[model samples]
Target chain A: MQKQWLWAALAWAFAQSAAATPTGDVNAQLAEMQARITQLQAAYEARIAALEEKLAAATAPAAASAAAVPAATLPAPSRGGGAGAFNPEVSLILQGAYQHKKKVAERQLSGFWTPGDAHADSHAHGGDRRGFNLDHTELVLAANIDSTFRGQATLALLDDQVELEEAWFQTLGLGQGLGLKAGRFFSGIGYLNEQHPHQWDFYDQPLMYKALFGAHSYTQDGVQLKWVAPTDVFVELGVEAGRGQNFPATEQDHNGAGSRALFARIGDDWGVAHSWRVGVSHLRTTARDRERHMESELIGEHAVAAFSGKSRIWLADFVYKWAPNGNPKDRNFKFQAEYFRRQEDGRLAAADEQGLALGESGYATRQSGYYLQGVYQFTPHWRAGLRYDRLQSGRQDLGSNPAALQTVDYRPRRATAMVDYSFSEYSRLRLQLARDRSMQGLTDHQVTLQYIMSLGSHGAHKF
Target chain B: MRRFWLVCLMLVLSAPVLAGVKVLATVPEWGALAREIGGARVDVFIATHALQDPHRIEARPALIARARAARLLIATGADLEVGWLPILLRESGNPHIQPGQPGYLEAARYVVLRDVPQQVDRAMGDVHPDGDPHFHLDPRNIPPVARALAARLMQVDPDGSATYQANLDAFLLRWQAALRRWEAEGARLAGLPVLQVHRAFGYLFHWLGMQSRGELEPKPGIEPTSGHLARIVERQRAAPARLIVRAAYQSDAAARWVAERAGIPLVVLPYTVGGSPDAGDLFGLFDATLARLQGALR
Candidate 1:
């Protein structure tokens, strides 16, 4: 009996190994397969070991004859299914580039000067004709837990610095079309900021983004209470609290450090083929007394805004990607774009008031600009894009104040050309050359090239 | 709300006689196979629509509503419907179709996948790179998948056990016969090196004995760069690729660019249902693809 039992156990283990391991590099999928294989292999070994031991033990006459029993065939059970299976998705994105310009980064501004947040000729000062960091890497992890909840965490190593991109949880089974999301995540306040910024078809962000959001780039650690309104139309609403941006020191009556903004966006069911969004944000921060510092317009923005009373920011933007002559997925088409803007009145206090320069800083900087871009997909995987940026700078008297940095005068115009090719879902490469002669003292000419590689199950997001 | 009532009404109107077995299918291809096996004794409906991108499909009131009334549910979940199928499974709340239940069948479980990536990541643009999700494109996968489906369906409707087994047996014989013919036909077309715009039919090529020299696009989601295409073209010129392949809905820019530059013929293959008018059915899809490839290569 003991020997008969031994053979049956050995068969079971062999069947187990056969079941583990499958094709695919999904972390969750491969790990499960590996675990199953180990378990089965162990079980099979023990069973066979026990069988051999039993056969040896049954060598004595009566048991030995009966031990010559039939071998049992066990069912193969190495499978991945049922509940509680976690998917570990691994991704690697490498952006490599060859550039023809010198390194250009916003030199860390002097503390409390808060002036140089302008798209003016003086914004870069002697920094023009400079080469810049061309390579950036972004990695993300996201998974849905059952049907009601999902979480995502992303880590970015870009421009030689690493930061958490997104760490948030979403509740899907809430009120109709309502999703409760919380955690420190990217504020979807701007157009290009929301999508893969580094993956922008162009070599750099539009001129408008550089002016309004500051050269430091945009990100705030705060909580956002948002909802997706129920309807055939796609609507989103959000309220946030964080370090406020864009306020001149002269405009605030209290601390401008803690900023707050409420914004909403509505898009048609048709998706990016055509969409529009508008938002109004207000912020305030405590003023820092930089009495004796050589303060630029960069630092004194909030102090100036606070002193000026009632700080606010109003923004509206729209994008319409049409392929009217042919299919949206194919064919050459024109990419339309436009945006309107205005700054708070009297927020632009000059340097004597410890604010921005005439029109660059604490001055109430009035601004307006729009652009037209067209992308023609000459081939399925090949596309060429051209865009023109026409912009206006707020005059020191009318738009400049303490928050504005320099004397606003020349409003530079920009034109760019981009050519790209997509090889597959995981890899792509592009080249861009453009001239930024729109700003004063900033007649910039440069060329940037980029390549992105995605390996593993991470490629699914491309589809 | 009234739309919900109308959907329910339609289900009631199509209510089958309890005498026949019932089967629920996830895709149209699976639905067709189930009918062929179950013959007059089964009823089936494909839950997913052909027009939708399989990966990004959203499960709405209608699909969830249909799954609840069905006795069996079949899906191609290798994270294929990462966006929605799981929602339907839970919301349908059909105890009968829950995972590990007698009625739930994940058809892709039976076969091996090709080009399984060693890693998976979101930055790769919605990758399932570990393994290809287009398993159904390869007809050889159908036999095992159909067998698994038949077994699950039979287990659910025990009274129709004989009918299910007989049907499955017949399918196996017919498939074996057909496979032999296909084998002979495909052999003459083996050893062909081609470039595919997308890896949509990686599974099909694996079983069909064709070699894909490279894909037109450099990466999965990222478009090709001029430098990359120039290199691909250079590679083609040296060894000379025989064919350039593409899907109907998908563009052929990369293929055309390389084909024109390298002087190779590009074959636009039907990737999915309705990829082309001639590829109306699953069998026809492969046949059309093979014929086009062979003709181009010849």
Candidate 2:
């Protein structure tokens, strides 16, 4: 009986409120009076709350100054000399994947020159093994060092080893559209090179990236200076000088800048829907006895060869994005393509297993490759992408060196497609398939199921 | 060639005469308010339009350029632009507009906010720890924010202090009169139950004494699922709301479906200035909003 009365009263109140008027009925009038009283009470309460908040707001600055007195008495932060505080914005990215592929004896790119041990470390290739695997777990910490500078460090943990992927400091208050960044960092040469692997739309690195810069692209201990033009169109020019210890440039003993890069980018928006950016860059470095291994048909054995001299690469990249009314929350499309041409001019020497030099040659070669990809977000959560990568052994001159150092006439290429679904901004799951023809006389059908998740600290999206 | 050089020289000579305090606003509402307060003493640039979701804005290079050149930056704050503004500030390399600087002003700091979360977690879906940043819908919240903006403008451009003060006083006088007129006209709208698309209109309902039946979204920042829509439909049958309401920027499919199933009128409010054809300025925004809500009554 009590429940029935409660239901009847609820129904009557709903009816009265829906009517939104003071009615002639006595019961309706009483309900309306009760509502008016409640509204008055709420108004008074809100006024009191507002008064209290005003009092608090008035005293907040004094309280803040008092708190600052205590904070000044505390010890200073340890890292980044003369920094402000120890607090830093931190984030962790966890990535894992499952892979299935037809087993191939060697996964080397056949037509192009490759380092012997490039793929020996499975973790370096983003867990390319046949079963379940855990990829790199990236931990990032960033903070403003002081009034003039800000610092960030990203550590990649794989297995039991921790690698410092990037640790750099950038100027915060440099006027005239000028900025400086220094320390170990990725060279901003191409659209994808500066972006971390976790931000990739696909599971694995592109064939062009892998064949050109190994698994990781153009990471170096360097200093960079960039200037952005003050014009309406976005224009940026940058130069980097670094101690190149990674792929394409072997580490030198005494380096007063072993490698250098110059890049220029121009971008603008077309109306409210389209945006585009185009860039060109050049990287020149020296390789000191970079090792390579190849099968020698003449000797019927694997011969070790070394290239020592200058290596130069030219790159051009373009990216275009389209969304309705500059809003990408629902549906959008992105197209990006990068092309690279590399030339090596130096001496190539073939050696035996006992370190005996068999033959030497004055080697000069030019190679080129390009990759283009398009990604479309059909719905709020789902996205699909297609990519095609092709590489050409443009020209090779082995000279009198052994046949093992000779370049084949074949071109390497691959086609890949992927679909990913993001549960939120923090987590995404993807399924990708590719037909790989990167190696000679091999067509390996590859499949990957991957998941990437981010914890703590929201990252701002950059374009 | 001589004429071109003469024109260039003239342009260079006149550049300083055209200079004013450059104000960069993260959204159209703040941009409109800055204009009303600064009048002829300031130049304003709005980063996002009313038809765009402020929370989902991307940090484009054009915004960075604008931010770099601005003397003052006005934002809603309380994490409303967390996804994009931080990047703009960092990449702009302009110290004047960084957080806590004299040129930076966050409007939420001056206004009373609603729906501050007790415990923040991702399970709740994109919760702002400080409070709701959509306090502009409540006419009462404007005076405080306008006063703060005028003070900030004075600090950024001290030469225009008197002009800013006079403009702010005139705006406040006009705003208060409009507020009184709105309250008198909106008296009949009291006690109306509304089903909302998101928590975008919390302060609007609070000011007007309207009851929210529920949100279409299961959680904040999450898309409405069919399961939650069905549940809302079931509840509507038991305690029916008078109308369904949504913002002009939000997708209307969910609200339309609910309105169809529940047999209620759906009213789309101009969430900010320039959100609709009728809402061309700050005054027009609220006028159009109130007019639409009252239209749903019939």
Candidate 3:
């Protein structure tokens, strides 16, 4: 009986041991298979890396490597800088073009100005190759500070620190079509004028803007409040104020009445697939013209024969925009037209007691311009546009300088056209041609090709 | 014209009186959550709908009026509404559902994240690498999500706290029970290797014990390219890819290419409420997603 029980136990033990062998065998086989797979993966990845390295190696040759490329032209990775993926959005647009024109061999000049040594050296001259220049290094920051507030800030290299360009804050909560924002922002004036510095189609500012508002593009540091009425089918009103930094002394930061400006825009976004907006803005500036005379070595003596002081320079602009914002692929048309006129008082020309006009009224210009631009979509990724700009102005109101006194030769109306292809929401390449005629015997035909590339989580854009 | 005039008058009279539970859901993030919690008890209007991205909602006239009449407001709250939500709320004039009011519920209360980036930066490309508001996706967190929701619902409708509690408890029991069954069944799919378009599956995979070998996108928010797809295909060729997952709103191009090249199945899931009525609510969304994946991969 003992032997029989022992035999049964031995049989059971052997059976249990036999069962464990297959499990171990299977595990070993699995482990071997996993090791083989990992090896194959490493080899495969190495091959991919080698191919990529070879491809990159093949594309390294280039032409005209210039450091003058504006930093703003390149869209750098900006994901970690902002509030979100699209915040702190940074884009750089680098444009290098070889222009082929018959007119003039690109004029380039170099010079340096000396300060306070004015009497010592009247002639200081040196020469070198007309090297290139980096025209822009625009930086932009846009974010929502916790859903309740959002804003945009930009700094650019275009104006090259003439204390030009701008920065501003915005308050954007309006229940009705009325939104209220107060800050040192743009004067909601022209179409492309208020866009971020890098968003311009070309590298140059419009002649109309430079001639009238100077290199700053109509920007100043002053508080502006805007009210956009509800999206009713009829009319909407918007107005702003505070002094733009560049307004002349005749246009002190704020005219006596708060640089008071008013705007009224009315239109319907619903029509035969049309949305039209027409508005007018007028500002009654408090600018004063003062005359300083050659009156005196005597502290108490006053020379009174000079022209008196007077507040003058009232500005008005009638603006209009027709945009079709409801297109599937942004294949829309925008027709913008604005007429800018300034009225001045007699004190502007009455040879200030100093034998010079208190105001450079001769540099004064009255301008009317309109742009009819239409964009057609070739594909979701590509768009082409044609733009016609016409600016016609009468002779200078008063020739501040003798050049204008020679003859009030107004500039011939100017025109520009452009074609662009977008690679993605953050990138595009454009080809543009512009013909401009200005008042100072300057007529130039410019053709340019530009490429804007954005890299790494710059965020999302609808287009 | 005559009927239009009469309808306007009717709308005006009915507008103020509909007193039907006025609720505002901050975004698509918690919009669907609020709807599930509110169930047929309230009328919920999602501040941002499913058509466009939640990050770029415009402050329009309709949104303000809707917010002004709301009695309860649910938001994602973690700086997600920085762009346009503030503008709408301030203008809405409804004092009942202000930021600190009882009617407010921030859905992020319950989630525990893994990749909450220690340091935030803008250069590495919109780093929410903090592993944000996406926590609502995991099934394990549903208990906390439901409880937090119940607390907020009781504050707005104290009269229905019992009903809300009972409903939450019932839902919890059902979800927990269903979760157990899913785990049992999903055991078959343990270590199931899948390819996804984004990191959206972090929670789902964590719950199911599955593995996502890799993603198609070069980075979390970056769009996928053909090159990335081809690389994924190479891996799929080595180890047969079972499924390729994508969100409904994302471009199906990447998913399609990978699945076609790898000879695998591509599964599209709704990432938001109202993306499709089939996956309308949270429960339906999970059910449909599981069925599709199980049917195709399992």
Candidate 4:
């Protein structure tokens, strides 16, 4: 029995050893499989890294070349790069108008003798003539001169003359909320004074502007200093010292500063939809030997008058804008009004047809005028506006000669209505109709069809 | 002598408090993001309100004053604020924030843009040749912009690099978790067709897997003609969009018109941080957007 048990135990031991062999083999197979997986993962990762590197290398030069290529096909590159790298922002504005008006041999404001209307060269400066007319062509060039300065030049081409509308260099990085501008520029006397003709809401100048500042508003060679206050509401104060070469001041030899102006403006937002701005401005200038030409109906000849004196003008302006929740894409409304009062203390010398002095007299005149207009954007691309202008002659005094000049009724008024359609922001077509009683005892009916097109790069207008 | 000494002391004491970097952001969303990254190290000023259309803004003296004082200017770029910002910058005379300077940060540079036109023409209606300027709507696009912004902050204010990195990391952590939650919650929104008033929501729709079926405007800035509206109506009838979407700053007239005709609900999404009452901050902006979208789906 002992020998049989030993043999059975040995068989059991043999069976256990045989079972352990396969289990060890299974564990070895599992370890091998795990090692193969890790090796495969590393290999795949290296391949991916190599492929990515190759792809990047292949695209790098192509991307660089693509970036270097100029996008000239695009309209008006805003940045200083590409094909027109050296070119400034150049924009050409073409304005043309066709008007129908009654035949008036001479166009003149009776009591107000202004410098802008003194030139009898052509019908371009007076008003829209009786046919298709090239109102003006404005060529604007604006660029950054350097890190410290930016320059802009606007040349206006009329029928018979070329006028430099604005040429100035504005300072950059002067700090302390202060800005300085030097050269010939429009004075910031009123809301509309600083804006160009193309930016006007109405087709014609207001009666107040025509009577107070002459046909064109005040543009003079000047240096301006402006300071903006650090406040929640917008507040700005500006002062200008100019050479009085334009209207309101016709100082022939302006070796020194002959014109000075001061203005203050404040603006704020009422809510998301409404905003308003109000401003007050004052201008003072001295005129010496200023020539003005007038047609004498009684003598059937032209008379030249030379005046010398002090001119002071005061202006107050207000503008309010409302857009539905500040989105003006669909509809908006703007109402603007400006009032001006002028006082001129000077002497007038009239010359006869034979180059003889007919009379020399001291005269003082006080006049005030105002215009209010409202523009409504009735649709996305259509707008309509209505304006009313009126003038009041305050007082006139001819020093000693009472019979030399008759007291003429000088209260002038006009009403204008206009509708415009904009094909885009750069182009618009307008139709304007007005009844002008600017001249005493004469009511002139005028109709105008105008079109304005902007050719190249144009910066956005300031509010 | 005492009064002079007192004034001097006041000026000396006030100098340090005012020494922080002044940053100006064109929109409220950029202001919020700048605040998050800048924390206590910067003072941020937002130029335009959320309710105001960024395309047009008045060149107010207050804006010029703030711009004049700002050391850093952050804008969405791509000519989104082309109308007023150029004038403001020129008038401010602040060299630090001028283009090509280190202090100027354009958020659009870091993200891949959409709707880049092949040819730029006004007939195309004010298309931005650089692409769509409204890329901030996508949550995923924020990380790269934030990273770039952090790098710029480090370059501008190297002394605060560590703090900026920490802030950015923390923001990314929270943002990643939020993104995961949003993705899960918005998974059902995939394949849902929608209509938009403008192409402003392209990035958001792309991220959410929502399909844009049509747009209200025939072109980018052009008003839709009657024929275009008729075509949109016909297309909607064929495919049937679930909702019509518009932004808070956009006029709702066209969207309402299309929605009423198509028999779909109109949803006004907060396009920026402060665009809606519920969208008070960055997180709230996304939360409110998702809620509105989900509500529309329901």
Among the numbered candidates, top TM-score falls to: 2
**Model 2 segments beyond 4 Å from truth?**
A1-86, A116-125, A402-404, B1-13
The local distance difference test score of each candidate is 0.56, 0.81, 0.51, 0.77
Candidate 3 structure quality by residue, lDDT tens digits, A1-463: 3335544765575456557676577666556656765665556545543443232234311111111111111111222335546545454434334343325332211010011122111111101112232344445555545434446565553433422244554543333434454555656554444554345555344544443443434454565555543333334355666653333223343343335456554443343234455556655444343332222222223222122122222233322222233322323443444555544233333343334432233334344444455555544455665555545554334334321222233444556677777645456777767765543355667666666665432432211
Output the number of the DockQ-best candidate: 4
Candidate ranking (TM-score, best to worst): 2, 4, 3, 1
| Reference-based lDDT, residue B90, model 2 | 79
Q: Over the stretch A1-463, how does candidate 4's per-residue lDDT look in tens digits?
A: 3335544765575556557677577666556645765565456544543443343233311111111111111111133247766678999999988888888876656567655443632322326368887777899999988878889999988856788889999987676667899999988889988888788887777877777666456786989998767655777899999988666777567477899999999887786778888999999998876776655443456666667888999999999988877667678899999998889898877776566776778878888889999999988899999999888877877576422544455878889999999988889999999999888778999998888899877887877
Best by lDDT: 2
Candidate 3: give the TM-score of chain A: 0.57
Q: Sort by DockQ, best first: what order? A: 4, 2, 1, 3
Model 2, C-alpha of A99: deviation from truth (Å): 0.9
Which whole-number lDDT from 0 to 100 does residue B158 have in model 3? 73
TM-score of chain A of each: 0.60, 0.81, 0.57, 0.79
DockQ of 2: 0.18
lDDT of 1 by residue, B34-57 (tens): 776677877676655343346544
lDDT at position B126, candidate 3: 37
The estimated TM-scores of all candidates read: 0.55, 0.87, 0.62, 0.84
iRMSD for each candidate structure, in the order shown: 14.0, 7.5, 18.1, 8.5
Chain B of candidate 2 versus the native chain B: what TM-score? 0.95
Native contacts retained by candidate 4: 0.32
